[model samples]
Target: MSPLPGPRARGHRLPMVTALLLALVGTLGLTGCASLGTAAKYDGGRLRIDGTDLSFRLPEGWERRDNEELADALAGSEIDDELAERGGISSSQQDAILDEVVLFAVGPGGSSLNVLTSSEALPPRAVLIDQVESFGGTDVRETDFPTDVGDSFAVAYRLDAQGVQADLLAMVIDTGDRLSVITVTTGSRAETDRVAEVIRTSLALR
Candidate 1:
């Protein structure tokens, strides 16, 4: 060969090619890592519901609506009117209808509540738990109630409704003076847990 193409020319070209390849590899690796991390955080199409800082990841193509307006509209309504307006169906036809559901924490008492209108009244806790277990595809977990709030309890369950299954967790805190409840509903158990965890972590007994 003619001086092996000259060391100066070959060496410079080789190092530049090597550096470009390394940079490309690094870029690809970073992109893959980011994708994996997002997938890991996704948690099967769920969203977290924090107090005021509600944050969670929803499933692709799923529509989410905030009912803050409805909450404000329905606040302090007697149960009958509340149910009627919420269901938007004749009382007789309310059976098994999965109406728009509302989850809210009332006050310092931390008594979580879920309000839904159905033709038939929901069963008691035991029966509700059984129904939830059947639909949620997971065992129900009961959490300890605060001692200060006697006879109040908190429970979390998974639910399948409207072709989508999600996690619904509620905390019922009843202080004799007042009742406060906090509830979080999410598209997945993981999302529900994340929201509930954040609420629990940031809870202030005002």
Candidate 2:
């Protein structure tokens, strides 16, 4: 089988792992909503993501989405090809789903911040690189930086396909039982750097 397209692939093509992550996030939302009885709250200029012990300060002019919106965005998308085949839909079903999918996003379309969680306990570095490579990323690079919450590793790469050139910054944090993948996507390298830096520095774990 041919490899799945990356996040920024032409049209609505997103990687299988990404689709899996989104599914996980949706499950977290539903499960958390039912049991936790809490929702994302805004206080002191920060948007605290509900359903989990995660929160971040929202950057200037940035917007925050709720768990319901996230679920809506990932709705009807299979987490993997096996599921897709079993469901009798195209393996790339997410391509059509993403056309209307918008998660807990911040910033404009060209540049934005997205967060997803995984239950797997893995090194942040491996998760970061594997995510980029899995999405058909090229010119991948790794770096580290300090954040208000803790030290985190970042993976940056480019996706140039179908005449669309987009840059992505995958900021990964391994918080014991879960992996937080915060992606910053933009059309220009400078925008990618600027947006990611603002959000990264403002992050505060609570």
Candidate 3:
């Protein structure tokens, strides 16, 4: 819709859904671990499924990061321009929310993962549908993804900007407490397939 906003050498106009995937991927691929050393709730080694004792392992080479790294990534990104042009959330607002709750992962070959959750009392299914409904992308395809834990939702899409295509996979998992939005973006379809395999196979009950 917004002409894809000048295809950043590295970035996306990430919103809650957008912000979680696009911007973060841009940052991870754009800059190295800017945070360098800090701990976040969700480490790349394993992430606990909320409202359950189950925890799943992230694929090797995935590094969990802190918000500071995200901030650093955004500093060198064109994500702001994309967001502005797309009529998405302001950088400041995005920054604030990002600080509150976001589990990030930087993986091999310019791939990234973003996790966002809310503790506010609400139905998980409703929130998941809301997130999916709000998503906007090119060549979008969605389906149910079955995990060892349960049936989750997955969306595959392409975000094209400046001739650079970001192949993305967004998986929404609802175990109980609240819905969890996990997004993965890669530089190509092959890469996407590899990463998706790692996630689907690696995600399991602790």
- Candidate 1 lDDT over 1-206, as tens digits, reads 45543222211222212212211211222222211111122233434333322222333322333335223333343432423333344433322221234332221111122332111221234543443343333547876544432335656765432234445665544333323334555555576565556545444433
lDDT (Cα, tens digit) per residue for candidate 3, span 8-38 = 1211122345444444344335334333455
Tens digits of per-residue lDDT, candidate 2, 1-206, equal 99974432122123325543443332223222312223344343765544446566655655555535553433453334433432345645544433333335545443445565545443446555665565456788986656655446787777543345667677766554445667676676787788777777766667
Better of 1 and 3 by TM-score: 3
Q: What local lDDT does model 2 show for residue 111?
A: 44
What TM-score goes with each of the models?
0.38, 0.60, 0.68
Q: Report lDDT (CA) for all predictions.
A: 0.36, 0.52, 0.57
Error of 1 at 33 (Å): 33
Candidate 3 Cα deviation (angstroms), residue 57 = 2.3
Ranking by TM-score: 3, 2, 1
Of the two candidates 1 and 2, the one with more favorable TM-score, higher being better, is 2
Question: Which residue pairs overlap in candidate 3's backbone?
Answer: 14-18, 14-19, 15-18, 15-19
Residue 148, model 3: lDDT of 71
Q: State the displacement of the C-alpha of residue 40, model 1, in Å, after optimal TM-score superposition.
A: 30
Candidate 2 lDDT (Cα, 0 to 1): 0.52
- Model 1 residue 24 distance off true place after TM-score fit, in angstroms: 48
TM-score of 1: 0.38
